[model samples]
Target chain A: MNFLESIKVAVNCILQNKMRSILTMLGIIIGIGSVVAIVSVMQGGQQEMNKTLEKFGTNRLIIQLNWNEWDKITSRDYLTEGDIQAVREMGEDIVAVSPLINYGSTAKVGKEKEDLLIYGVSPEHILIENIEMVKGRFINDDDYKSKRAVIVIDEKLADKLFEEEEAVGKQIVITAGSQNNTVTICGIIKAQDSALGSIMEGNRSTVYMPITTVNKMFYDDYLYAMSVKVADSDKIDEVGQKIIDLLHRRHRNENKYIMQNLTQAIEQVNQFTSTFTLIIAVIAGISLFVGGIGIMNIMLVSVTERTREIGIRKSLGANRNDILIQFLIEAVIISLIGGILGMLLGISVAYMISSLAKWPPVFSIGNIILSFAITTMIGIIFGVYPAYKAAKLDPIEALRFE
Target chain B: MIKTKNLTKIYKNGSIEVKALVDVNLHIENGEFVAIMGPSGSGKSTLMNILGCLDRVTSGSYVLDGVDVSTMGDRELARIRNRKIGFVFQSFNLLPRITALHNVELPMIYSGISARKRRKKAELALEKVGLADRMHHKPNELSGGQRQRVAIARALVNNPAIILADEPTGNLDSHSGEEIMAIFQRLNKEGATIVLVTHERDIALHTRRIISFRDGSLVKDEPVTKPVDAVDMMAKLSDMKDKHNI
Candidate 1:
């Protein structure tokens, strides 16, 4: 018989035993469902990680003095503007270097005070951090050269301190240690909105002033750390090592500084995700294998139950090939239906979990197509033996069967 | 036309062999009505199986409608069975799940006939067997005789060379049996070739000739001097039934 006719016959037979057919398809459904769900969730998590890492700045490296030996540290171990100039003159790979000093202080307007974490940076900090401005402008060379009492604040702090009034061009008094100074708000930078960004920043209001201003007003100009931006990110670690070596030589000290970059962090996250994906894939494979076996077992039972029908058809005019095709089509249709249901289940589960965990949900056409192909292959692979057994039945014996 | 030369069938069960049919030579022409009569295990059913191409002979030749099918392979034998022979079994083997129309269409389906033409031919065959109104009923919904009629419609839908009935009336009541026999007789009168197997002498009397098998061999083959007309017999049965009711 033709393929369409065989499929029709198969469908009729399956419909005649509705519960049995669905039971046979259950293994495939669970198998494909877990695979799709796990894969989609993992992809969504990886995408979010990559986005956060990219925002953290891939090409930026932080060089910091090791503070564990604070009692043994000397004044000569501190990084200086001379060291920053030396590193900038080292090679073309170095984009910009700027000192970064953080201090916890309080800002005041009249008698009202709000706690703030203040950062002292140079003009190049804008390039290294990719800071986007909302109004006014970032710290410039002119502000650093003249030691202008000007500062930049984030939009959140601007909204909090000045309320509806513009915070830019306004002055806020800051108290640091036992020293206090008045600084004008030169600009307002955009606030971070990502889940990871918010967690890292917490509720601390942030304000940025020129390093010279902070060194002159708050403390002595003994730098503890510096941020460097490299042009070719592929060699970021190597360039970081070169700069550290140069600093250690210039300061005439050993093991006093360390370098950190985002590339290594990115690699660690990738490794973890890939390992998890591999484990999940193995589990999904086992499920599919078990499901395929279930289909085979059910198909064998169906073939045996329909032996008399096979005999009748054979006696009428059906060849072995006809009988084989009929049963094979039935098995394939069952698994395919299961696969479709499983994919839908997987997608919904992924979305549900994403919403609960606050990760982006991703669905790809390639994955759906792959699932279809795998299910079809599973059907053909598991169905052959049962269909062959049915086809090989002797017409006389089959007809004689009760 | 059907012919068998030195037809022999042996059943082998491990070390033991049962000779079902031995040295059976038979011939029946086109438009002939014949009956094969024998007791159980007399090799009559074996001969029927060989004639239907459901089994192969051990050491003999059989030709149906001018095709030498004794040595044919399983595939070629299946084709021969599809195109040349129609079988009506004692159990009225209509597929229980499908309607009578689809059961009649089964043979044409295997023969690769289009759906529209198969439906038309199945309907026509069912009409011929006087089951046109019951065409959509499942087998369990029909009486035993109507189911046999449906089986007969399925058998003849493809217009095969011969109709082989192995005790087609065996499952029915006397009235239904007579009705089945009358249909066979009418078909025979319309230039169709028919071969029936029955142990009942009354059923054999309706055919023009009788072939009797004994112990794996054909012992007798003779034409009936006077054949009983099944239509007349059925009419007599109904008349007697009516009188008894009164």
Candidate 2:
């Protein structure tokens, strides 16, 4: 019989037992449902993470004193002013370098105190961190050279300290250890808006000031970490190695510093997402296998129940292939219908969770197509044996069966 | 046309063997109506199965429409059954789920006929059996006589070389049985060859030729001097029932 005729026969047979057919498709529905929902949600979260990392700057590298060995560290082992000058003059591929000094301090405008991390940096820090300004301008060369007491606070900190009032050009007194310095805000930068920002840094606000002023006021010109920006991200590892080697020689310490590339962090995040997705996929695959077994069980029962009908069709001139194709198509249609329904269910569930969690819903056609391919293969693989059994039945014996 | 020479069938179950048929020789021309009559296990059913291309013989040759089908494989035999032979079972074997029209269309469907053509041919066949108005009703909605008519239409839809009916009226009342016999006789008179198997002597007397079997062997073969007319039989049956009315 022709394929269309087989499909018609299969559909009629399935319709005759609608409740049983739906029950047989349940396993496949749940399997594909969980797979699509989990994968889409995970992909959305991964994409958000990538965006946050991009905001941190993809071509930037951090070279810092090995903090794990802090007990054995000396002041002389710190990244010095001479080292910064040497890196600045190294090559055209080195875009910018700035020593970063993170000092945990509190700022007060009158009696309104806010917890903050004060980063002491040069004008190059803006380029290395890709800091965006909402108002005013970033620290200039004169601000660093003259050791000016100017600060750049993020919009979130500005909102907390000044609330509806202009924060730029205002003064807030910062207390560090036993000393206090009143600094004028020079600029307001955009606040980090990603959910990851709150997760990684908590609720503490951040502000930036000139490295000269910070060094003169607190650590007395000593620094532990430096941020470096490169012209090309692909050459970041090479440049970071060169800088670390230079810092080692300049400080006369072989194991004093380590280079951490931002690109490597991005790759690590992607690897982690892939591993998580793979683990979930394996669980879904197991469920799909169980569903295929369910299909096989139902198909075997159907063949047995319809033995006499098969005999009738064979007597009417249906060959072995015709009977085989009929049963096989029935199985495939059941799974395929399950696959489509599961896809819609999964997408709806993903969107529901995304709306509640405040993340964008991700929809990929490639993954959808792949789910279809997998379900079809499941149908064929599980359907073959039962169809073969039906095809090989003896017509006379089948006819005689009650 | 049907021809068989030393046709034999053996059924084997593990180490046990039963000879269902032995060296049966028979022939009937293209337009003849023949009856095979026997008791249960008398090899008449086995012989009908072989002739219908539903079973393979253990030895000897059986040819239908000049094709030697005894040595044919399953696929080739199925083709022959589709194109050259039609079967009517005692159960009226109309697929219960489909309408009378679709039941009649089944043989054509297996023969790879198109939908439009199959539908037209099925309608014509159903109309020929006087079931044109009940074409849309399922088998369960039909009476025993109408169901048998539907089966006959299904059998005749493909215009096969021969029609084989195995106890076609066994499940029907006398009135329905006469009606089924009348349809068969009408088709036989229209030049369609037919072979019917039955244990009822009265039913066998309607055919032109009778073949009897006993103990896996053909015991008698003879032409009826005067076959019973199904119309006349039905009229007399109705009069007898009416005269004995309570």
Each model's DockQ?
A: 0.71, 0.74
DockQ of 2: 0.74
Candidate 2 lDDT at A318 equals: 93
TM-score of decoy 2: 0.87
Fraction of native contacts under 8 Å reproduced by each candidate: 0.63, 0.86
Can you give the TM-score per candidate against the true fold? 0.89, 0.87
- Model 1 residue runs over 4 Å out of place are A65-78, A101-120, A130-136, A145-224
Q: Considering only N, C-alpha and C atoms within 3 Å, which residue pairs clash in candidate 1? A: none
Which residue runs does candidate 2 get wrong by more than 4 Å?
A: A69-80, A91-93, A101-120, A130-137, A146-198, A201-222, A231-242, A248-256, A352-358, B14-17
TM-score (chain B only), all candidates: 0.98, 0.98
**Candidate 1 displacement at residue B202 in angstroms:** 2.2
Q: Give me the displacement of residue A54 in model 2, in angstroms.
A: 2.4
User: Compared with the true structure, what per-residue lDDT tens digits does model 1 show for residues A171-271?
Assistant: 99998788788889999998764544544555567778898988888767789899999999988989999998999999889888888787787688789
Write down the RMSD of all candidates, one decimal each.
3.8, 3.9
Model 1 DockQ class = medium
